[model samples]
Target: MQIATMYFKDRAQLKLQDELLQYNLNKSKGKFVGKRAEAIRELDDFEATRDAAKSIRQRVLDNLDTWLEIFEENARARGTTVLWAETPDEVNRHVLDIAARHGLKKAIKSKSMVSEESALDHAIEAAGMKVVETDLGEYILQINDYEPPSHIIAPALHKSKEEVSALFAKVHGTAPKTGIQELCAEARAVLREHYLTGDLGITGANFLIAETGSVFLVTNEGNATLCTTLPKVHVAITGIEKVVPTLEEASTLLRLLTRSATGQSITNYVDILTGIKGAGEFHGAEHMYVILVDSGRSKVLASEVKEALRCIRCGACMNHCPVYQNIGGHSYGWVYPGPIGSVITPMFIGQEVAADLPNASTLCGSCASVCPVRIPLPELLRKHRETQVRLDLRPVGERLGLRLWTWLASRPALYAWATRLGVRVMKWLGGYEGRIHSLPLASGWTNGRDLPAPAGKTFRELYAARRRAGRQT
Candidate 1:
C-alpha cells in the first residue's frame, strides 16, 4: 500500500533476524516447490500448455486496446457495466461512486490484489461503510489491523497455525484452539454472517473471457462464489491484462495457473460469471460491474518490461525465489514481491524509489525455469539494473565501482594482471581456512556468510597449462 521500497534494506535486515518468520517461510518453501514439481510431472502436456499460455498473453499485450474494447462491448451487451480507471486513485473513486449510487453499505470482499494495489478497503472504511474480508487468509489479515499480505497466492503464509490460533483467540474473544479444523470453523462462523448480509461483494478475476464476456474466478475456498452470488451488487476489480481472447485460451492459461500456483490440477471452485442474475436464476447479483484498472500497466506495456504483463499471478517465481524464501515477501515492501516484484515495482513506481528491488535478485535463474509463462525474469531484472545505471539512480559508491570495473575490463592485459593479483591477494587473506570472513568494501556479502577464496591461479592460467600439456602429450 505504502511505498516502503526505500526501506528495503532495513526491512530485509529485520526479516532476516526474525526466526519465527524464517521457520514459517522454510516450511512453506518446500511444500510449494515439491507440490509444483509433482503436479508438473503428472501433466504430459505441461510444456505445450505453458507455450500456449505465453502466446495467449503476448497476443493480448500486442493488441491490448482492441481486446479491451471487445471485452467492454461484450460485457456491456450482457448487462454488465465495464468501467476503466487510468490510476489507482481513479479506481478507488469509481468504486466509491458505485457504492454511493447503489446506496450500498456492508461490503464483503474475496482476495483481490488489485484491491490491495488501490487500498480499496481503507477507502471503503473511510467512506463510512463496513468492508469485511471473506477469504480466510484475507479475513485473518483484516482482523490483524490489515497487515499487508506476504505472498500473493497465500496471503498469510508468513503466519503459522499456532500464531493464527492465538490471533483468532485475541480478535474473536474466544478460547485459543490449535487444531486447523477448529480454527477454520471459528472463521467460517464469523464470516458466514457477513457473506449473507453484505449488500456489496468485491472480488478479483483470475482471468476475463472476452468472447463470452465472463469473469473467471478461481479459488480453493469457494468464497468468491458466495461473494458473486449472495450480494445485491457484485464488483470485480482486476488489471486490464487479464482478458483473454476466448474461453479456450483462458482454459489453457487456467491449466498452467492452478498447477504453477498451488500444484493442484484444479482449484476447489471455478466460476464463469456472466453479467447479472438471469430471469430464472435463483441466486445472483442484481448489478454486475467490472473495473479494469490500468494503473501504470500501459506504461509497462510500452516499456522494455512489457513481457511482465503476461504474469498470471501464479507466484511460481516468488515461491521458487531464494531471496523470497529467506526474507519473505514483506521485505520487498510492495504489493508484489519476489522476482516479478523486482521487475514491475520499479516500473510501476519510479526507479528512484524502487531501484533496490531489481538488485535484490541473485540471478540464479530458478524463477525463470519454474515460471509457467516462461517470462525471462532474470533478463528483465538485468534490464532494470541497466536502466538504473543509465539514470544514475544507484549510489555513488556502486556507480564508481562499476566504472572502475568497466575501465579495467576494457583492457585485456590489464584485466588479466588484475585478476591474477586479486586472486593471490584473496588467497592470502583467506589464510589457513581458505574463507574470507570479512572484506573491506563488500560487507554486504561477508556479513551474512563467508566467501570462498579463489584458487592460486586464474582460469586463463589453468587453460594455458592444459593446452601446453596436450601439445607435449
Candidate 2:
C-alpha cells in the first residue's frame, strides 16, 4: 500500500501511534519538562514577541502578492533562477527536468518538509538520480528504511537516541552504543562523504525574505550549509507561506521560533546564502533553483481557514498540547501533526481521507494558547468536524445517537421519560454499591470506570421539594 493510504487506512498505524506515544511519554520524562520550563524562563517577553510576530505575519499575508513579486524580482537580480509549481506533479517534473539537464547522478538533501510532502526523493530516484539525506536525523530515518518525517522541527523526535544508535550500527556495521557523541561522530563522517560526492543539493528554507530575496535557513548542525555549498546545483523546495515581507521580519519570527521550539536564544547556525559567491565557484549549486510550491496554499489563502498558513512550523503547539504530548506526532499520520495537523491535513488530503484527524483534538484551547501565530487551531479543528458532520462523514451509529439525543432534547415529556428509565436501570444495576461496575453498551468504559448511580430525585423534583419547604417555613 502507498504510504499515504497506509497512514490513513491501516489500523496498525493507529496502534503503532499509540505505542509510540507511550514510548515518547516515557523517554521525554525529564527532558520535556526541563525544555518547557527553560522556554518559559528564557523568553522574558514571549507574549510581546509572539504578538509582534503575529502582527508581522498578518501584514505579510495581507500583502503576499506584492511581497512575492518583489521577492521574485530580487531573487532573479541575484542571479538565481526561480520556478513556480502549481502542483506536486509539476514540481516533480521541474526538479527532474533540472536533474536531466545537468545529468545529475547523486543529490544531497538537507531536511525539507516540502520535499517530503512532494515525495521528491522518490521522484529523483525514479529519474535515475541517487538522493542522499545529509541531516543526521534524516539520514538515520533514511537508513532505517522508514517513512517521511513526523515532526516539522525535529523530524526524528519520535525515535530515541538509542534507536538512532541502532540505526547507525545497522547501516554502518557497528554495535549500537548509548554514547551520543560517538553516534553523532559516526553519522557526521558518513554524511560528509555524501556531501563531498553529491552533484546536486536540495534544501528547505525557514523563511524567504522579500526585501533581499534571501532564504534564511536555521539548523542545529551545519548540514544545510554543506548541502547548498558542496553540490554544483542547489534547489530549494518550500511552501508559499514561508515567504516574509523583509529580512528583519523574518529575523523577528526566527527569534520566537527557535526559543518557542527548543528554548534557544539562537540556533547553532543561521546563514543567508545569496547567489554564487564567484563566477568560477563550481563548489555551490552552480545553478540555484528555488521552487515555490503552491500545491494548496492559494486555496488555503482564499478560504476562512487561511489563518492556518500563519504557522511558522515551530512545533510549540505540539510541545504544549496535552493531546500531542500524550499521543505524539505519528498518530496523526501526516507531514504535520498535532493541532495544526488536525486543521490542515483534511484540506490537503480531502475531508473524506482525513475525517478522523479533526476528532483527534480535545478542544481544550491549549493549542491556541501556545501557538506563536495564534492560528485559532481549536476553532479550525471544530470547523473541520462540523464540515465532516455536514458531509455525512460521521459513522452511522454515532450520527444516529446524536439524532436520538436531539430528538429527546427537543421533547420535554420524552426526555423526562428517558431520564426516569435511565435512573431506574442504573439503580437496579448498582444494587447497594450505588455504582455500576459494568455496562452492556459501554463495557469498555465500565471495565476501568465505575459509573455512579443517578440521584433518586430529578432536578424538577428537587426544585419542587425546595419550594414546598420554603412555603412551610
Candidate 3:
C-alpha cells in the first residue's frame, strides 16, 4: 500500500539477513523453476505459442481503444455494468458506491492484484463493511495483520508451514497444526462461512474476452468460482490490457499462463462468466459488474516501456529472476515484484519515487528467457536505468563514476593504461593469497565473499603477446 520504494536498499539488506525468509524463498524457487521447466518441455511448440501470445497482446495494445469499446458494448449487452477508473481511488470509490447501493454487508474476495493495488480491503473495512479473503494464501495474510503478498501467484510464499500453523492457531483459537492439509482445512472452515454469508463477491479477470463478453477466471483452489457465482452481486476488476479479441485468443494465452504461473497444464477451475444469472439459472450472481482500471496503464502504453504492458501477470519472470530469488518480493515494496515490477512499478508510481526499483535487477536476462510473452526484461531495466541517469535520480557518486568510465572508454590508450594500473593495484591489494577480501569502493561485493585478483596481464596485453609469438613462428 505504501510506496517504500525509496527505502529499497534498507529493506533488501534486512531481508537478506532474515534466515527464515531466505529458506522460504529458496524452497519456492526450486519448486517453481523446476516445475516450469518440465511444463514447458512437455509443450509441443512452446516458442510458437509464445509468439502467438505476444502477437495477440501487441495487437490489443495497438487498437486498445477499439477493442475496449467492443468489449464494453458486448459486456453491456450481456447486462454487465462496465465502469472505467483512471486511478486506484476511483476504483475504490466505485466498489464502495456499489456496496452502498446494494446494501451489501459482507464481501468475499478472491486474489486480485488490481484490488491489492487499490488497497480495496482497507477501503471496504473503512466503509463499515466486512471483507473476507477467500483464497487460502490471502486468508493467511488477512489474519496476519494484513501483510502484503510476497509473490503474485503464491502470495504467502514467504511464510513457512510452521509460521502459518502458529498464525492459524492464534487467529482461529485452535490447536496448532503442523501438516499442510490440516492448515488448509482450518482455513477452509473459516472461509466457508464467509462464502455462504457474503453478499458481495469481488474478483480479478485473467482474460476479458471481447467477442463473448466473458470474464475468464483461472485458479487451482476453486475459490474464485464461489466468489463470482455465490454472491448476490459480483464485481470483477482488471486492467484494460487483459482484454483479448476472442475466446480462441484467450485459450491460446491460457496454455502459457497456467504453465508459466504454477507449472500446471491447466488449473482446477476455469470459469467463463458472461453476465448475471439468467431467468432459469440457479448458480450465478444476480448482478455483475466489470471495472476496467487504467491507473497509469495509459502512460505505460505511450511510454518506451510499453512492452511491459504485455505482461500477463504469469510471474514467470519473477520466478526465474536471480535478484528476486535472493531478496524476495517485499523488498520491491509494491503490489508487483521482481523483474516485471522493476519495469512497471516505476511506470505506475512516478519515476522520482520509484527510481531505485529499476536498479534492483542484475541484468542477468534469465527473466526474459522464461517470459511466456517474450518481454525484453533486461532491455526494459536498462531503459529505466538510462531514465534514472537522465533525470539525475541516481546518487552523484554513481553518476560521476559512469561519466568517468565513459570518458575513459572513448580513449583506447588511456583505457588500456588504466586497466593495467588497476590490475597492478589489485594485485598489490590481494597480496600472496590473490584474493581481494576487502576493497574501498566495492564493499557491497566484497562484504559477502572474496573477489579474485586479476591475472598478471590484461586481455589486450595477452592478445598482443600471442600475435607476436605467431608472427615469430
Best by TM-score: 3
After best superposition, candidate 2 residue 406: deviation in angstroms?
A: 3.0
Ranking by TM-score: 3, 1, 2
Residue-level lDDT tens digits of model 1 in 1-473: 88899899999999999999999999999999999999988778888878888999999999999999899999999899999999999989989999999999999999999999889999999999999998898899999999999899999999999999999999999999989999999999999988989999999999999998999999999999999999999999999999999999888888889999999999999999998998998978999999999998999999898999999999999999999999999999999999998898998878899978999888999999999999999999999999988997888998889899999999999999999999999999999999999997999789889999988799998999999999999
Off by over 4 Å in 3: 455-473
Per-candidate TM-scores read: 0.95, 0.92, 0.96
Winner of 2 and 3 under TM-score = 3
The Cα local distance difference test for each model comes to 0.93, 0.80, 0.93
Give per-residue CA lDDT, model 3, range 1-473, as digits (tens).
77888888999999999999999999999999999989988889999999999999999999999999999999999999999999999999999999999999999999999999889999999999999999888989999989999899899999999999999889899999989999888888888889999999999999999997899999888999999988999999999999999999999999999999999998999999998899998888999999999999999999889999899999999999988999999999999999999999999988998888888777999999989999999999999999888888999989899899999999999999999999989988888999999987999889899999987579999999999999999
lDDT of the structure predicted as candidate 2:
0.80
> Residue 399, candidate 2: how far off, in angstroms?
2.4
Cα lDDT of model 2 by residue, 1-473, tens digit: 02352254354246445764468555653464467557657677878888999988888788788888888888888877889998878888999999889888898998888777778888888887899988877887788775566677877777878778877788799888789899889888888888889988889998888888777899999999998887888888888888898877888898878877777878898878676546765545578888998988888787668889999988877777777676566667777877887787787767887888788767999778878788899888888888888999999988999999999999998898788787888888888989889997788579779999876657876787899999999
Which residue window of length 10 is worst by lDDT in model 3? 353-362
lDDT of 1 at 229: 95
- Residue pairs in steric clash, candidate 1? none
